[model samples]
Target: MTSVKDFRVEEEPTATDLGRGRFVFSDRYSVFDWGEMPDHIPNKGASLCLMGAYNFELLDVNHVPTHYVGVVEDGEVKDLGECESPPTEMAIELTQVPDLPHEDGEYDYGAYHEVAGENYLIPLEIVFRNTVPVGSSLRKRGEPADYGLDTEEWPEEAVDLPEPVVEFSTKYEEQDRYLDRDEADDIAGVVDLDQLEELALAVNHILTDHAARAGFAHEDGKIECLYHDGTVKVADVVGTFDENRFSYDGQQVSKEVVRQYYKRVQPEWVDAVAAAKQEAIETGEPNWREQCEIEPKHLPDEIVDALSDLYCAGTNAYVDYDWFDAPSIEDAVAAARDLN
Candidate 1:
C-alpha cells in the first residue's frame, strides 16, 4: 500500500506479460515524505480517482499509451463516463515494481535491473516544469537566466518559463534526488532516455492545455512509466493535484495548499523532517523518518473543510463535470487563502 492508496493485485503478471490490479485511493495524505498524516481530507480519494481517470481518458484519446483500464464501481470495472458516482478505486494494468536494493548508503541499480527485465516500472520520475514557483528547487539548482528569465535572480513570486523544462529524479530511493541526463539514462535501463523525455513533454503539453482551458495554471508535475516489450507507457496516476502543482488566480488549486498550510502551522515539524533527511544522508541511514523526532499535527477542521472543497471544486472545474456538490473554485480558493 502507498501512503495515500491501497494497492490490490487481482491478477499477477508473467515474466513477459502484464497483470491486473486496483488502486483504492484513500483520504490519507502525506508531505515531506512522511508516510501518512494525522487528518483525512473529505472526499479526497474520490476526487483524485475522478481526476486521474479523466486525465487517463484524455491521454488515450490523444494516442498516449497508459496502464489505465477503468474505474471500479460495485465490483465492476466501467468507463469513467459510465460511472454513476465518483469512484475511489481505479482498475489498472499492473507492471512489475522490483524492490530497489539499498546497501551501504548507496542504491544498487545494477542489481535492481538484473531482476527487473522488461515489463517493469521505470525507477525514475520524469518531471516537467512550465513555471518556477517560490521555494522551487530550481532556484537552488539554477540561476534565473538558466530558465530564460531576463533578470539575474529569480523573482519572489512564480515566473513562467520560456519553454518547459524536463528533469529526472530517483523514484525508489529513500530520499529522491535529481539526476543528470547521464545518470538518468543509466537508471532508465531498457527505456531510451530521449524517448522518455519526449513522452514526458507530450504529457506536460496535454496537461498544460487542459489546465489552461480549466482556468488553472499547470506549473509542474512528474510522471512515472512502465517499460514493457520495447515500449514505455505512462504508469500510476497522472495530472492529479497530488502529482502536479496547479494554481488559480495565483492561489494554489492543488495539494500545495495543504503543504503550505503545514509550513505555516507546523514549521517545527517541517524543519525536523528536513533535518532528519539531511542527517540520514550524512549518516547513511535509509529510514530517515525514524530519525525525525517531531510528528505532524492534525489539521484544523476549518483547514480540512477548505481543502476538501478546494480539491473537489478544482476537480470539477478541470474535468468540466459536477461530480461533487462543491462550491465554486473561486470560493474554495478564497476559503483556503483566508486560512493562510
Candidate 2:
C-alpha cells in the first residue's frame, strides 16, 4: 500500500486472490506532508514494527479485528515471538483501494463512492483528542471553548480536557479538511458515521489505558479503518510514536518533539505554510502548496540525532524493553529540550 512512511507491499502470486503481502517498514520519516525526508533515524523501522505489532496483538486478544497476520524476519512468517524489537517486514492481509480521481482542481468523490462497492479503505481519518496541546490544530482552526475548555483563549501550555473529543477529517484529498458528522457521512458512503465514531472511541480507550500503564500520557491519536466483506477493521499501524502523541511528565516523547524543533528552526517557512493553508480555506482552492513558495531546509544534524534518540528511547520505555542501546528517555527528553 502507498503511505508517507516507507511501508512497501509485494504480492505473492501463489497466494489466493484474497491479498497477502509483507509490510516492509523503514527508518524513513515524514513531517509537514513532506514524504520521505533526507535522513533515516537509526532503528526507527524496527521500533515502529515492534510497537505496531504490540498493539495489534493487544487488539486481537481484545477481539478487535485487524489486517495483521504475522511478522516477517529472514523471509519467514512468524508470530511476534519475543517483543524485543521487530525486523523490517510484517505480513498483512491486503484489500482493495478506492479510485479517487481529480480533474480541473475538483475531486470526484462520487465516482470513488460508486466504484468502492463494499471492500476498500475508508476515506476518512477519525481523530481523537484527550488534551489541547501546545501545537494542536484545534487551536488554529477553532476556539478553546469549542472543546469545552472554560477559557476564551488557549493557554501557551497544554490544557487537559475533561473527556476525550472525537472528530473527522478528509483523508484522501490533496489537502485534508476538517469535516462535521454530516460531511463525514457523505464522503464515507458505506460506513455509518455512528459506527465510525464507535470504533474510533473503542481504539482510544484501549490505547489510553495502555499509555497510562506505560507512564506516558496519551494526548491524542488518529486511526484508519478498512471496510472488508461488510466489516470494518482497524487497518493500519497504531499506537506508535509517529501515529500517536505521547508525553512524559509534560515533555513530548513522540514525533511532536521533531515538529517542535522544526518550528523553532524554520519559523518563517512554517508561518508561510500556515498562511497558505488558511488562504486555501478562504478561497476554497485545494492547490495551496503551489502558492507556498518556501522550501523546508533539511533539519540540522544535531536536531536529527536528538530526534533519533527520542524515538528509540521512547520506544524502549513504552514497550518496556531495551531493544536499542540508547540514552534513557529522561536524558533524551532533556537533550531535546536543550535544543532550544
Candidate 3:
C-alpha cells in the first residue's frame, strides 16, 4: 500500500542541496500540449519511480556514474535523524548540472554549448528499434527501388530487423527527427563518438537480455547521457514498458496503446491531431488544435483488468519462454466487445 505524498516539485528534495546531490523528478504526465488529463493511469507514477531507481542501481553496480542515490519510499521526508527508509517516491542524488537555455520554448544549443559546454545534459534522445511496425519511418520509406539510399530489401510486413537500428532525436522532439552519426556527433561535441556507439550497443544488449527475462523483447529502447566529467552512464528509466515497446506474445501494447488509440478508434479527430502536429512542424507553431478531446475515453473494467494483467504477466513472463503476460491479439479483440 505504498503511496507518494508530494506529487509536484520542480527542483531537488531538500531546501539546501545535500553535497550528496538529491533530485526528485515530477510525476506529472503530459501528451502533446495537454497536461494532466481527466484520467489517471493507476500506479503509473509508482511504477515509473521504482523502475528508474532500479535502473540507476543496476548501472551503479556496473560502475556507471548516474544521478542516483536511493529510493524515497512511503514515509521518508527530508532526513533529520537517519531512519531505515524515507518517505515519498524514489529520490536519488544527482549532480546539479545547469539546464540549457531555450527561447520561445526552443532549445538554444548555441547558449547551451557555452554555459553547459561539457557539463550540459547531452541535448538529445537516442532511440534504438528492432522491428519495423506499420507506420515506421522505414515502412514510410516504402519498397520503391532507388527512392533514396540503396537500402537492403525491406519487407512490407512487420518484420523483425536483423540488427537493432539506432536514431538520435533532439531532446523531447515530438516528431522525432532522425540523426546520422555525424549529426549526432555534431550536437554532442564532448561526447566520444566511438564510446557513444559502443554505449548504445551495450545498452541494447543489456536491455534486450533483461527484457527477455521480463517476457518482453528489448525490441528497442532509449538512453540520455549527460557528461559531467569522465564517466558516461545510462540516464532515464531503462527497459520499462513506458520507455520501450513491449509486446505480449506479438500483441501490440506500450505507447502503441496510445498511438493506435489515436490512429484507430477516433480516426476522425485523431487524424486532426496528426495534421495539427504536421502543421506545427511546417509553420514552426506547435498549436495542436485538439488537446483535451472527450476527456480521454476510459477502458472497460475488464480491459483495465486485462491491462493490469498484461503488466503483471510481463513482470513474470520474461522469466521463461511462454509469453503468458499478454492475451493473444485475437483474444484481446474478443474482450474489446466488453468496452464501449
Candidate 4:
C-alpha cells in the first residue's frame, strides 16, 4: 500500500489492496475547510457513496465513461469493529485519485494536475441554477453581488440576462472565481467558448431531465470534467441537490433542508454565519469555516434526524425509485416551470 501523509485509515469500510484497486472514501466533508467540525450529517457519507455509485451506473447505461469500478457486492462488505451501523446499505469501488499536494501543505492541486495528466481535474465548474431560492448566497447578498450575471458581482438590481449565466471557476486560488466568457476561454484555457457551452448544456439537460421525472424542475446544475483518455464523459454525480439546484412543488427544497436545521436546531450559529459572511466581504475572499473559533459544533439529535431524513428524501426524489410517484422527466420540468 502506498503510505501517504495524513492518509488516516477508516475502519468502517476498509479499502483492501484487492490487487490494483481499492474501495475508499472519506468521512470528511468541507464547506469551507471547517475541518472535521464534530458535526456529522448522519448517513451523509453513505448517501454520497450510494448515490455516487447509483449515478455512475446510470451514466454507464447512458454510455458515459466514468471512474467507478463497481460497488461491493452482497458478500464484500465487512465490519471493522469500530462501531455498529447498518451494513453500509451498499458499498462501491472507485478509481483512486491520489491526494494532491497542497501549496501550503494543502491538497496539492498541482500534483492533482500532474498526476491526472491530460485527464486532469479540469479546474472548471459547471454551475446551473433553476430559480433564485431563498437563503441562496445570491438571495442573501441582496443584490450587492450578482453572481456574475452580467459582470463580476454585478449590481443587485441586475436582471438575469437571456441565458442561464455561465462563469469560469479558477482552480488555483483559495477561492473559486467566476470569470466572464473571455476570461473563461482566452485566459483560463480550461475550455473553449463553444465547448464550455456545449458541455454545460449537456449536463443541464441530463440533470433537468432526471429531476423532472422525479416531480421536480431541473432549474440548473454543474459538471466537473476531466479530459481523461482523450474523451469527455460525465465525471461527477449529475442530478443531486448538492450538485444542482432543484425545487419541489415550486418550493426551494434542496439545501434548505440542512439550512433549516441549522436555523432551528442551532439558531445561535445563525448569527455566527452572518458575521462570517460580513468578514468574508472585507477579506475579498472569505473562508467562514476557518473563522469559527467555536470548534467542533455539536449537532443536536433533532438536527441529525432532520438532516438524515432530508438526505433520504432528496436521494429518493432524485432517483424516482417508485418509492414515491415522481413524475416522468418531462412532466416534472413542465410542472416546475409552471411555478414561474
Q: For candidate 1, which ten residues in a row score worst on lDDT?
A: 253-262
**lDDT tens string, model 2, 168-287?**
998888788888788889887878888888888888889899888988899999988877767888887888888898988778877777667678888887788889878977776777
Cα lDDT tens digits, model 3, 1-340, are 1122233333542322422333343333334334453344544454454455555555566665665546654444332113242122545433334555545746555655666544446777778777767667756544624233245676556667666766787774444566777877877767786776667777777667666665455566787776656566565456655677767556654545544544556666556656676776776654445432444454455555554444434433433322233554445433433332
TM-score of predicted structure 2: 0.90
Strongest candidate by lDDT: 1
lDDT of 1: 0.92
Runs with alpha carbons beyond 4 Å of true place in candidate 1:
none
All candidates in order of lDDT, best leading:
1, 2, 3, 4
Residues 1-340 of candidate 1 have per-residue lDDT tens digits of: 9999999999997669999999999999988789889999999999999999999999999999999999999999999999999999999999887888888888999988888898899999999999988899989998998788899978888899999999999999999999999999999998999999999999999999999999999999999999988889999999999999999988888878878888988899989999999999999998999988988988888888999999999999999989999999999989988987
TM-score-best of 2 and 3: 2
lDDT of 4 at 217: 68
Task: Give the range where candidate 3 is weakest over 10 consecutive residues by summed lDDT.
Answer: 1-10
In lDDT terms, how accurate is model 3?
0.54
User: Which prediction has more favorable lDDT, 2 or 4?
Assistant: 2
